[model samples]
Target chain A: MKRSDYQTEYKTDLPVMVTPLPKTGGSFRFTLKPWHGFVILMACLVSSGIAYAVTDKENASIFEVLVRWMPLLLKGFIFNLVISTCAMAIGTAVGAALGLGQISLHGWVRKASWLITQFFRNSPWLVLLFFAMFLLPFEITIGGLTIPLPDWVKAIIGLSLPVMANVSEIVRGAVLSLPSGQWEAAESLAYTRRQTLWLVILPQCVKRMLPPWMNLYAILTMATVLASIVGVSEVMTLTGQALSAEGGQTYWHRFTPLFYYCFSFTATRFHGGRYIWKRNILLSTKHCLRGP
Target chain B: MTTNEEMPMVSIKDVHKSFGDLEVLKGVSMDINRGEVICIIGPSGSGKSTLIRCINALNDIQQGSILVEGQEVNDPNLDKLELRKKVGMVFQQYNLFPHKTALENIMMAPIRVLKQDKKEVEETARALIKKVRLEGKEDNYPGELSGGQQQRVAIARSLAMKPDVILFDEVTAALDPETVNEVLLTIKELAEEGMTCILVTHEMAFAREVADHIYFTDRGVIVEHGPPTTFFDEAKDPRTKEFLSQIL
Candidate 1:
């Protein structure tokens, strides 16, 4: 087809450009609506009420046991957050470089990056966690300085491998999605290839990359639970320990751990959702800056 | 030694370009003089755009040479950034950086590539933006502007480099009919200001009015070329006549 005809067809098929509405003070506020908060409160109340009614009269009430164990379980949950944050930080830093390597001008770099990304991305997350746990040395000596590697540190490394691969894919996909006209325009203006990629191409890629990157973070946060199997004392492991300590016979007591898990997961997701929404507004405002 | 004015600004000699199996330009040759306005008119697949693109080394030719001033453009060791700095191009899509305001788009290359002082570049950018007759739209993003306004910004962007010659590759081909005149008027003003311009266009009337020389091509070769008055009015090749008849 003629280039003009192809361009016209592409332009018509483009999703109508949405001019963002004027930002009022309230619009930029937190995304968790009052209804969401109410629903969470109701679920907590109903679950606790059910647990309180069914427990043996002589034994401690499910609510009382929960109150006793809440501090320990909260500590474990905080550890989970730490694991997720560290894993995500390491993954993003390594993954961005790997992703750029996939598009590098050197054939060897591109092929090697592709192989590494595919190898880690396709392997099961649980397997990678085990591999990190078993294969990595327990301690390393660097110039007379010894650093001990803890199980939780190994779990962070294990979880980061897959996150890195997935993030690599996200970066590569976002870069490729941009129109070729951007590169050509930059080239005609005498910009070097490196200058074009940094200034013109990558800045545009950030908006396209943001949503998927956030999605990967959410998945990585959930995957941190898998570290429990590899011997990290994360929330799942602590919950299992707490259940055994409370005398594992009662049916009513079993629901307490489920309740704790649900609450923690929901809390993380709510915060994640809010964060993604706010970043979207900030990026769009930077790029679009709605004119009068 | 030849004087600077005597040397052609851009010279092409027996250039042959191909895309894998298909040959687009078959030994095409042309010489564009300093301060001259040359318009290339042809059917869709006639290699008009490809030829102009070759002048800036945007497309590589399989055979023969292209020179900007006295320097060979196709040399492997040639600094393309240097070549591109001297020869600017405006595309059909008006590929303005959507992330930047109109003023920033005009100012970017001079500041980033040329490493000019930001204040001086900003001054020149504002002047170029005003030259394109887009005064109040300086702060508007490319997405917020009409197609004509965006194209004008694109023109101003290329002009910011202060290139010795500029190539317009069917720049108005993608615009609405109402907006086409605004873009064409911008080009006409640039031509009147004696900017050496080589345009590939379908606008016959505008070509007749502004072009110092007109080249008609068909089947990957220039069928005829001459002063616009003779090229358009006098008897010429049957293909040129046929192409002109269909368009005009």
Candidate 2:
């Protein structure tokens, strides 16, 4: 029986979602677009609002609880931002080196790069963070003077390790994606291998690399909340402290998911806007962009 | 040794090339004198493109000696950049760097390899752009230009280095029928101005018009060669006759 026939028989007035019939060979039909992410975000927000309204307390509504704590939470969010920025800077430099090494002519250099990338990439993030916390020297004694390293510095190093691996993947992928014609053309111009890479190849790769780089940055930003576990006093840790208060205990379960959902949506939106803007600028600025 | 002093601009002797078991060039030899234009014509896989590429040392032959301006091409100690500065090549695909504008593409090799003053190179680049009839496309990227315009820009780029000889490999083969004449005209202008040129082309009419000498290759061997008048009209070899009949 046809789907429309069932609807007519049941006398139902539900809106029908008519998707295209699947082809014979493949039985998969899933196409999620960029706007779908926004739709999902909006749906989450609306549902959470309805849930808050349904579970209204006598003394404090959801609005009052959020108003009381958001300012305090923002202070810690700043620290989270700082940590993420520092880690990204460190990761980018290290990852670029590894990526270049991955394509190095020397076999040992390529192997070393592969080993380093795999070691960090395959390990669990939490374990790496713990190792950094325990294994790193807390203080250095040089010439009878003591220099102490902060806990967040350790956290940054841990976070950057994974980011370094991911960025190396992006760089390698971007470099490989360029057509071989660019290389041959540069070579015919009498460009050295290094010059060909720096001038001809890498410049073309910048456009291909930007979107993934920004997406990785957004993911790294979200992962910065893990800094709280190492006693870095970031937003998540501060939120935990706020919820441990006497009256805060009542809203703990609701507030945690609410904060996470909001933060995730913001990061995703930042990434989406940034990727589009970067691609547009790259397209427009072809004349101004020059290679080494 | 006196003959060595007046050596041809490019000399390829008994060049044999192979990729795995497939031999592409077998015992092919040619001498290209200064200010002479030679057009290599052949069917597919006849080593026409390979012969021109070998002159620039783009493809290394297994058994041969290729001398460009008396410099041994295969010599490890010889600076390749110096040799390439004297030999420029244009591809069939018009492989312009997408990131650079037409002017920048022309200016790149001169400023970078020659270490010439940027201002001087830019001036020469602009002049060459005008010579190629692409005066208004100075600021346009390769992606923005049509195939004919891009090929002209590529010709301008190869001309920028002031090379002794320029090799064109099926340059107009990728262009539309309407636009092929512009690129061909640009090359013809260069030829008339006494630039040493070796072109591997399928355009029989253009070859007849522009070529000072025509080398017809068949199966990695130059089976027939002469001035355009005699080569086209009074060809004697059976293979050349058969080849001409098939094409004409």
Candidate 3:
């Protein structure tokens, strides 16, 4: 059917344009997506406002504060990056396994996966981090060899537990969202259950899984700061120490709002944040491939 | 069970199927002979589609025997995947693997299930694509193709298995009025090539033209069946005549 036919059949007011939009004759089309320019304005104003508030006679310029402290705080960011990357890797692996288990034919396996996912998903992240930090044996005796568990390793494990649960939910939701026709088609073709899941179902689920998985990664990235509570010396921990070392309570007014402004902008711009709030990317792909 | 014509290609004897308490197929039985094109026609609630699905064991009968080439379908020892390889099916919604191109969809089962060489199967797939009149469109994904093109590709995908029989369940019902004839033509070509075929269809005219045997079903039973000329033109049963008149 032609594009126009769809509009008529559905009784829709929106015109369906098959070809590209008519190009603006102007040489430069300085177009910003809806709220993008506003966000950039906000970020600049909010950041400079915080910097200006912290300024004093001794620290005459806000530029001096930034110049002095930016490098030191950035060094701590490497640790944040490390913890998040490690946790995400672990979470994705465990989550995928749990997700597959949730759909398993065996009753016990499905139940066990459900129990595990629910346990971590319900618990607060701070409580899990505390459990990791305090409950786990700091040292292990393996054939008279002492293996000390670092605080950062425990933090990563704690962060991953929640991430794993969330990612598994994403995987399960993605798999379930696929139409029953996909399974029936593969089954009719003589593909075994395992073969159908691996070859047909999971491949289709990847499109569904990606945006949420990326979203989960962003959440997990921010959550890495929680590791500082247990003295992991990540970005948040170092930022605190660096601020206090530079000054006392006065530095809080400077760096805290700076942190908030930077984080808000990062959260808004990242894959998990605004895009998920708008059109769900994976579902839209599905709609594009399979017409309404 | 010798190489005699007495034995049916697929024999579904007194098969019964139900979804919970609602019995979909009650004592349904039919014998599909080799090189025959059977078209099953009925109203919406009839067991026509269910019966066709049972032939390929897509739905298991609650009670009865379904033997394909004299092999019991529900035999515990029988590998269902192996059985299905020989019984190709085309669905109403052309369920082409959307990720794969048309040629890839056709080549997948033979290469994966039959363990055929990629080069050899690609040659056959290309030929089938050409036969479906989808030449130069082999590289297009299902999403890129029109409904008729997708259905034709689905037919080619089934034929790539070189199955003993092919089942088409309302293959053209989901298609446009203009595109219906294109999908019907592909099926007509298959029937002309002497491929054993069974179709559940709403298109009475096409069934009348192409079907060697026509089964008129109502509720969950095949009430009357005969050659298309006898069934469509001179239906014996009152229900068959009623169905014919309504559809015609």
Candidate 2's DockQ is 0.41
Clashes of 2: 0
TM-score of each: 0.88, 0.83, 0.87
What shift in Å separates residue B186 of candidate 2 from its native position after superposition? Answer: 0.3
Q: B2 in model 3: Cα distance from truth in Å?
A: 6.2
What are the per-residue Cα lDDT tens digits for candidate 2 across B15-34? 89887898989898889998
Tens digits of per-residue lDDT, candidate 1, A1-292, equal 4544644645653445433234656655556654665576567667766665675556676668878888887788778889988999999999999999999999999999999999999999999999999999999899999999999999999999999998899889988998998998999898998999998988788777776877777777778889889889988787788778876534333433454446545655565434553333244544454342
lDDT of 1 by residue, B91-179 (tens): 99999988788999998899999999999999998898889899999998887899999999999999999999999999999999999
Docking class of 1: medium
Question: What's the distance in Å from true for residue A42, model 2?
Answer: 8.2
- Model 2 alpha-carbon drift over 4 Å, by segment: A1-60, A140-147, A246-281, A284-292, B1-5
Better of 2 and 3 by DockQ: 3
Per-prediction DockQ scores?
A: 0.55, 0.41, 0.55
Q: By how many angstroms RMSD does model 2 differ from the true structure?
A: 8.9
Provide the RMSD of all predictions against the true structure, rounded to 1 decimal: 6.2, 8.9, 5.0
The per-residue C-alpha lDDT of model 1 at residue A46 equals: 71
For candidate 2, the TM-score is 0.83
lDDT of 3 by residue, A1-292 (tens): 5656656666675545343233557757664364764575566656765756766536546556656777867777777878888998998999999988999999999999999999999999999989888988888889989988899989988888998898889889988998888888888888889888887888778777876777777677778888988998877887788667766434434453444345544654564433442332244454554534
Candidate 2 lDDT over residue span A103-161, tens digit each: 88899999999899989878888888888888989987899999887899899999999
